[model samples]
Target: MRRLLVPLVLVLSVGGSLGGCGWAGRHAETSKPDVFQLQGYVSVGGAASGVPGTPCLAPTSVPDVVAGATVRAADADGKVIAVSSLDSGVLAQASDGFRCNFAFRMKNLSGSRPSYQILVGDRPAQTFQTRELTEGKPAVVTVTASS
Candidate 1:
């Protein structure tokens, strides 16, 4: 009886340790793809520029102008998946002239989508393939807005 009890205790101990390994938790984590971050720049051009043919006049006010504006990401079916807001704007020199460029970042975006449609503010959506965003590189998008 003592010998039998010793083996049974050993078996139960081994089984309990394996159960505590948390296989289910690890599987749940592996089942989901890693989330990606989307970083972009919003360039306000046309009449929205404080000064035509030059950089914005009041650089500080650029942030106020774009405040509360949102950046949205939609799947092929036009389902809105994630959203972010413009961070802040700064005057940047451009070939045509100068423009107010605002930077933004959207986190926790799934890379499972075949493609994405990005819409900044009220501008039209721009389509991008999944590879463009998930290639282990920073996906910098430039959105042009007009007044």
Candidate 2:
């Protein structure tokens, strides 16, 4: 019983260490644990995917912007563990505190890509360029303005 207890204790300790948000650094992208990602979007050192929605300056034909980006450790049942909102642009890594990014697109009347800013958590993130939509060229204006 004593020997069995020692092994069980060691195994439990190792498993616990491999659990929780601490594992975020390793499985940040592989598992959904503390993971969230949207398509058409780009993130650094993590997961990058496309989000469903038109640029901020989308035309009437454009639909609502849907942000689908995140990463989190979840259960086998697909239950959420930790949810983190993600933005597809430039990612800033903090050396001390926390930093976040956000953006919103507005359909531009001009054909040129419009520069805009997005607010996150009451704070405005840096400016990002996106398709504003011009006259009629393609069925839907497609732009990939990166800052």
Candidate 3:
């Protein structure tokens, strides 16, 4: 009886450990989603065109300018999920006149949100559906601002 009991205990112990390992792996995978990246461009239009050598206005400093401004991403319920800063503006000649283009990247965004609202500085937020923003594709957005 003692010999049979010893082998059964050993087998149970090994089986429990293996089952625990599998459970842990599945738990980790379901806990969170894969990392996602969101990229976009902000264009400021209806503003005085600046020369190549002139300093561009930062988005935060000006009311409508988006360059060098804080870009925030919010979920459908208006909860901010991710935040990033816009890069310096690159002047580009537009058909109307001139526009300042700024690029920004927000990383590790959750895929669970149905839509995303992007707000730059104090400007109004822009809404984008989940289908509009793919995992690796960059979304270009135009923001019109007057100087």
Task: Report every candidate's CA lDDT.
Answer: 0.66, 0.32, 0.72
Candidate topping lDDT: 3
Once model 1 is optimally superposed onto the true structure by TM-score, how far is the C-alpha of residue 5 displaced, in angstroms? Answer: 30
Off by more than 4 A, model 3: 1-27, 47-67, 135-137
Better of 1 and 2 by TM-score: 1
lDDT tens readout by residue for model 2, 63-128: 222244332322334343334343433333434322222332223122232432332222223333
* Worst 10-residue lDDT window, candidate 3: 52-61
RMSD of 1: 8.3
Residue 87 in model 2: lDDT: 41
Better of 2 and 3 by TM-score: 3
Superposed Cα RMSD, model 2? 18.5
Q: Specify the poorest-scoring 10-residue window by lDDT in model 2.
A: 133-142
Which residue runs does candidate 1 get wrong by more than 4 Å?
A: 1-25, 29-32, 46-65, 136-147
lDDT of 1 at 97: 59
- Candidates in order, TM-scores: namely 0.61, 0.19, 0.64
Model 1, span 31-144: residue lDDT tens: 644568776666654324344334343244334347457888899988999888876566766677566766677787887778778877555677777776777444445544
Q: Is candidate 1 or candidate 3 better by lDDT?
A: 3
Model 2: residues with Cα > 4 Å off, grouped in runs: 22-147
